[model samples]
Target: MPLRNPCALLPRRLQVVASLTLAVLLFILLLGSHPTSTSSTDYIHRVPYGPAIQSSAHQLVENLPQIPHDLPHVNTPAWLNPFRGPAHTPPPEQANSSSGEARWYTDFKWRNPFSSDTTLDEERAVLPPLAERARVYTYFESTSKDDKTKKIELELLQVWRRAWWAQGFKPIVLGKPEAMNNPLYRAVQGLELEDAMEKEMMRWLAWGNMGTGILSNWLAVPMAAKDDTLLEFLRRGEFPSLTWYKGLESGMFVGSRGEIEKAVKEAIAFPAINTTKSMFEAVGKETFAVEADHGAIAFYSSATITAKYPLLATKLSSPSTAVQGLALLPQLINSHLHTTWQNTFSSGIAVLKPLPAHTTTLIQPALDIARNLSQCPSTPIPASCPPNKPRCKPCVSNNMLISVPPVLRNTSSLFTIATVPHPYTLTSLLHSRLDLGVKFVRRETDRDSWTVAATKELLGTGLSSFSRLPALKDFVAGSYGEARTLWLVAEEPVRGDSELDLDALDWHFGFQLPRSPVSDGKSVTPVPGPERRPPPPKEEFGEGPPLSEQELMTERSMFMQAQMILRDSATGSAKGKTRGGSKSFAQTREVVEAWNLADTEVWRFVRAWDARRQLERRGWEEEEEGFLGKGTFGRWIDKIT
Candidate 1:
């Protein structure tokens, strides 16, 4: 009995192992006896990659590391040697010139900027010239009729002029008590109050040929003077500071003359949308339903563009005024002939939503003409297209409108009007540099639940087609920027604290918001800093509070240094001096310098959004429906059939 079963005498572990081995052998035999049509070998052959190999069966495989783990350690063959041998050997290049074309899987390109270095050249090319002369255009909207209030506003403007003078820029004071009466001010009355004000100020600045300017409502003091050096950085095109703001200040804007002109041209090209039926009837038939609230009406105007055969109704606040961004249809149409086609073509129409809809009446006719032009064919010179200018026509349907104005009829591309939810102030102030990023600051206070509710409703329902998405940051580099729009909606209501209010309006409206009492016309003291803090340290003779002098100076100095670094790196590249290790080192330095001065919160988000977009776009390319081998064929079939 003791010798009968060696397995029974074995240890517990050995006994269990023997039983498992027998079970496996029995199972394999059962599988082999009743083989299915698809065998394991056939299944293995159908695997996505090559057939699975029994690496463990090889003699030396047991000690060899795994495939990926040891892949880098594998010795290179002599044929694959990258180095050039002797002088007799032909020179070798790493990349084949013939195969330089982008590959579907291997090659990649970023549609949006992920790094400052990638866009440095583009940014440099678009930088605004630091003009020889700079002028200050200020606007102050007064709710109080008291003479004392007007006096204080004038004093504030004087303070700003003195500040600019200290920085060596001539300050032409164009501020008056009635400055806010400009038509742009009225257009944005019901929406984006501060942003509209800034745009109105920008138009006035541009018309005056004031190359350098600031738009402020005299609510807060100037943070810095017009910076030409910064303009140099801005002209390069990438993340240029076209519109700047301080954390705790009033609608502070400093931009180049070029920015003003560019914005004015865009504003003029596309008229503002007039919500009044009488005015809209003039542009085209008022097809869309009109909402009652200011915000809702604004939403409908902009959202209208997303429709099939979309027609936009845009009107300038006052077309008759020479300083008006959308003045005199005939003269404005002629002015477009001298500008680059991209100036008119790339940007269709951008409308400021104006009140007192009368001023915008003339723009309707122009918009109708543009809508007809959009319908004109993209190819083979339509008779209506001008011989000299051939660009993307603003087309609606295939049918041509013979009633179109003679000057506008022959134009290659008619401007597509973009009726924005907010006034085009931020759009105009930043001008083309607006593509970098946009941040909207909304002030929701417990005092006004109606406002909070209205804000949430507008933001949630998608004021513009872009804001419809929940992840605004995700859309920053793509849809929002692509659409040339930025709508910063508040997620929830906030307490009306000075700091919180200042931060919300920081990007577009930097002024310290008036408190409930002040807004209600009650007398309240204007404290420079936060409401509770001791007054900020004043400049000599207590002229005004100097809050950001050191910070501003430091910022300006850093930008100057970065400018020099960029110049040197560019020169090195041009001269072909830096190559190999030196070239790479220079490039690394260039990247660091490009973003060295970008410390503002807006830029921080811009960089983060861009990086995320790059990563997503890369991953998306492998599975995107539009690509050749991706899902294009399936999508095409789905569409055709």
Candidate 2:
């Protein structure tokens, strides 16, 4: 008793020590879990590489940092922009990068832009001169109305010039025989392809040279101007600047706000469903009286949940008529021939919902057979499809009309009226390097990286399908003489500021949204920088009050420097409350309808739905019968059977 057993005492002592050790370890683990953002340029990608600094390599991804901690409000810290999610957090510092020219041909097989420095031979190959006169882009005010098709043509030709995309770059885009000169091509042209080929073809056809329409698009200008230093105007198929001259036919010039607005407007379109009285009797004799609103709700929910389709909207706006009437009077005969096809196929649905299991049971079978060889593989297809042939898998039914058709099925007119043509004023202006842009007095790389990171994340999260997802073209479209600094904007939505009215009728929600930076799948990492306060915003708009969120977005698009600070229009504040507003019955329904019309987009979800159908098509016939009759996508069909 006097001396406790020595062994026992030793055991007790060891137990105490072990408890203490465990506690300490837990403390360290907890501390490590706490998010701590360091103010360091360690993770920043400061590439001497041309313009773009968003790192693509995985190792360059810093720790997946939560949205930055101390970003200046004026910097319009991305975190404050509500609607951002965890995946949107910036990557912690330590991301490293060296000044390397952006390798243009990284993914493509034929091109290797990164192998060696830009070789003289390669450079020459991309930009071959043809005519003695190099083409120069010119911006002008048009006296007539905007021409939609012409606008696309101008943009298409210019993009080819800048990106060095030729006819070869264009995938067959649907080759099989068509009842009307490629229904697939016509169906997706303006709404998707942007009519690049038609513009080139029109140019040739107008000149009585139908055979060489594509050749004309090559834009064969001479290597050098008469003075010899190479045409100062054209480079590698691109004419950056719009040549300003008299009698050059007036063209449309919508401000930066207008372009952005066009984008947003397209996001808002939805099919109008008649919320009139309709009776949906259950499979049993129990028929309940259904209200119009209830019917719409039921139909929309059933369509979305069953098909998983997202509605889509398209901007129906025409480009400004700053320039009209071609220099070479467009041949009426050829114009008719080229445009006739477009008119026939120029239409697309703004909203298309998938059929319910009951309807799809009848329709999808036909669609699967009809669409068997027209869709692209590799890319995920819409929800409804037969298995094994995702690329061109046939649908269960083809003659099955969509949930509802808007302008798409409304072509009661005899001629397919394609939209008018307009030039790519924006790109042309930039190519010429006319040197129009606000000068950034200070340099801030950190700000730029953050902006790029957020943009990439958004695109990856499904915004890529949006027609107006801003990319390399939107950011660096126009030329700024040696753009030194990019602005990190915290410009908020304040009333009474007037430089740009993003809320103006056509300029509001729908149009402005087109330029929203997209997010690709990339870890969010803070941009590196010397960390100085951004200089006072240039007073280009005079002593007006601070601009509202919409206005700020428009201005940012035009300037192309500052990262925009937008209040979620769904919630008119920048406090990062993360709250989303529910539109009224009508408004909300519209968005749902928009999601349904997504032939190309909502198709992924539909394909998912269709996979269930394929599963149903094969065997599983023993499943239960009747409405809930265990159609495709039936989870317990086999179990029930």
Candidate 3:
């Protein structure tokens, strides 16, 4: 017997209704199984089902019956509470009181769940005494006869001394007079200046035998005083007898005095030329005619010594073998600095795009001027410039020259190109003509090398200027433009003043009044004013008292609230859309405005608290001034008395 159709059993109207209901159920199941892609705006606006389910489960758990207070509890094993050992039992008087209920969760107490149980006092006990700390020696040889250069070197030495002293390390400065006493120094006195400097450091290290010490150059500034890995290595005495920076041995040296002395003596006795040739042969390169410095000689000698005595020397790049190494004390190479500056200048110009027609027209002429300046003859022409005059040369390589094109001199447009001294003057002139209302504020320095003082001044000025400009702040906070203008100025100069080998001519531009605003054959140059010294280092090093626990907690809570506000605003933007079915830009603007207001209020509160703290600290300082005087030495004197 064949089965009849299911629809034959029902009435005609009921059969049609049953077929429609089955089709609707099938559609619902398919729709739920495969979700369609949604726009970002829709995705943000979608309801969160995860939190809803979590809340429902939490409610169910809360409705369930809890364990009775009178139920017998099992004691947890001591091994389970490894952080704090076994749980403590309540006293006899409090055992039967209401506090007994609190003891039910006593097994969960953790002194420090994240770290070992070793106390800070135990760590401090193993630290070496101040006198026993490793000594770091830096050699300062003033090759430049410029008084300004010497003054800068002295200032750097003072900074270095303070940095090392703060970290409980002894820093010693070596000079020409100290090196003259070493017999090894006298043997290698006839070498070239750079080679001689290296040999001098080696001789001093060998002769001094100053226990565990480091040999470093003056150019290597201390970025941080405290390195836990370095400190632990020193504390445990786990390093080999002689340890140097991994890639380059000359950058830094750290070792015990005895091993370093032996290594230095062997390096000094080795023939420099033969060492260079051997190194070239080892690398499968032909021996080229180049002067062998102390670095090469030392590397060769150390390799030879290590072959016989494996434990005498080692090279380290990181704290452990498993971790990658980073340069802690980077040697500032001139070529590297020039490349970095070029990249920065190009990238900065690249971000300002879709330039005005007027700005775009001036770029080619500027490039021509740059090319002309770069190709100018080495000698000064009397026809182009008169003798005994500052403007004798068509172009000068020094940083002092601020060249302005003849066209924009009288345009009534405010254009300032703040940049380092590049080989091309046209780059700065073009930057000024961009009409961005930007004040390019570059710190002027006397030295050829980049200085910390210059960096601080530049950063401070930029930050202060940014804080005052709402447009700049918005540009930084929002994504607005793409970087595509770099190719436009790719033909510009790639070298700076430091990379040039020519002597800088003392040239200044003579600006004549009643000059035509149009492009003329004559270029306008404004003489830079007298040099200004950077602010004192004390402000950079000085730190105020740390934030109180309450202040810290407030900051954490505010940060969390700010994060939540940002997240909610992102999702709520779709809800605040107009009738056009688009996310409202007005809503975004309102959110940003609200955030700025909240930020202003928060800053005001912080400033008020800081002012109050300063006042309190001042009062305490004034009270102590009577006995401590003004300096740290005075406080020590008072203590001694």
Candidate 4:
């Protein structure tokens, strides 16, 4: 005590100075403010997050199909699923013609689950296999001088977790660094490491204005692949790119598998457009939309394109890139047949962008350039149509066409991964891909229209849980740590909005029916900007708008030379499922309900809790390890319960 008095009781002036410093600090915190700090990993959302909202909207539980009683359920889809009408038509052309939609859904070639060794990355890494809550974790394994990055990482995960849990998701997360299992996280526990973390989320929305592939970049971010390229591409600023893009925005194009085929076929009637080795880049993107700090191709161009060609992508493969790789060749072929332009590659006329799946129709734009721009007839140069396709009279022979190597990348596997929530609806999503196509529509972003009918129904049911949602409230409250298992729903994009409402914890969740895409203001939401593109131009490049009969015949003649280029994505490959596929969000709900409503192993664990026994009376690990010991999700549920 005497020693404590000596130093602690420094000179009166020194003590006064210290007190003043502390007071100033308090005053600055209470009155003035400093710029909030964020982590690099506070990272631009690795995926486009769905519109966040807490409302009385939900789909009726009755519409959900029963869990398959067997290890495999027939690919048969239930009515009212993502597929529209009783026929569950994926494409009118084939829905009525195909024997079973089963042939349309294919299996996955691989499923890369979340894996990480770094402590900092423990919370925001890995490509979770679940559908709804794929989380990410990052590590700042830097020197003592680099603790700032580590703190930022931790802060980012915490804020993300808060946002996700508040949105009612049982997130598959990369939790607090201290909670990390890595050896390093253990060493940094005593310091105020989290002090510099930022609590605010920087708000912004990204429309994949990058004209081509949003998938590769989205999936690459969590993998720590170059993300600046994607951000730059979106900004329209040139960055190091495998290729340059001169295409239109996706939202501007009207897409549909069969419809595209129909349009292309009709356009093919034009003696002008030729189809050779059909060239189109998948511009792969993971379509999950939300980032959980884990890895994944959050949304590839295919996912975006599929949003328009739901029935087609669904009929093709699940979200796992592995599955897509297996079906890649086939999917491309299919898309080619539907889109109609021949191989611009062999003919030096491939879509200005090589990959077509991830992009929209720019046939007219390509045609416009062909008309106005002049090219060296002998070279497969940019700006002009190829000179070599079956001698289209407009050009001569000997033009060397620029060619893309027919070799698919190691596609041995793409360098991509997507974290998905588990016991998820991979199957449902697979089926929903083709089968659920009719439910959502383009521009169906209104909050009040029937377009939101399905979402309203879902949130409506989820809101009922609000009465028992104290745990959810506590999680969101952040100040109070309350944990309880509650209903979670992810349907923001269905009704489309940017910010989420905070007080939606106590409302009942509901669902409404899907309406036509043509809703009057009833379905339109105010998008911050505009949707503009020019119409097809008449009068192109050289000879008067009219090419002589010989030229028209020559242009038409080019089609036969590049026949292989016409792939038809409209009719997706055999519908299949694989060991590598992810679970769907819808499937996640069903699984949760199945466990809650029936006698199951998960329920068994929940029932073993003996809350009445005194802590001292039981052995250390044996008694309390009931529900928490099962698995990550099991522990998560017990926390919320």
lDDT of 3 at 359: 25
Reference-based TM-score, model 2: 0.15
Report how far off residue 602 is in candidate 1 (Å).
Answer: 13
The global C-alpha lDDT for each of the candidates, from Candidate 1 onward, is 0.30, 0.22, 0.32, 0.24
lDDT of 3 by residue, 1-641 (tens): 99999898999999999999999999999886634575567866675578887998899999999676447888667777779654444322212111211111111111121101222211010111113445667665556565544454454454444444333345566545445555556654554334544645443544344445666554432321133345334434333556645433354456665655555455455555233322222222211222222221112123432452222223222235211111111111111222222222221111111122112222322322222222212221112221112132222231221232221111111211211211111222223321111122122212111111222332343443213323222122111200111111211222112212111110000001111111232332111111221111111122344446575555444434333333455355433343434434334434333323322222222222223223333343355345332432211111211
Residue-level lDDT of model 4, residues 24-131, one tens digit each, is 999988886644695455556553354422221234455677775347656655663766555322321212111211111111211112111211121121111112
Model 1: per-residue lDDT, tens digit, 261-325?
Answer: 45433433334423222212223222222222211000111222123112112232333431222
lDDT of 4: 0.24
Q: What is the lDDT of residue 230 in candidate 1?
A: 37
lDDT per residue as tens, model 2, 328-442: 1111111221122122222211121111111111121222211211111111122322111113222222121212211112222211101100011121112222121212101
Which residue segments of model 3 deviate by more than 4 Å?
1-131, 186-211, 224-227, 234-239, 273-641
| TM value for model 4 | 0.15
Q: Can you tell me which runs of candidate 4 are displaced by over 4 Å?
A: 1-182, 191-541, 548-557, 564-641
Q: In terms of lDDT, which candidate is stronger, 1 or 3? A: 3
What's the residue-level lDDT of 411 in candidate 2? Answer: 29
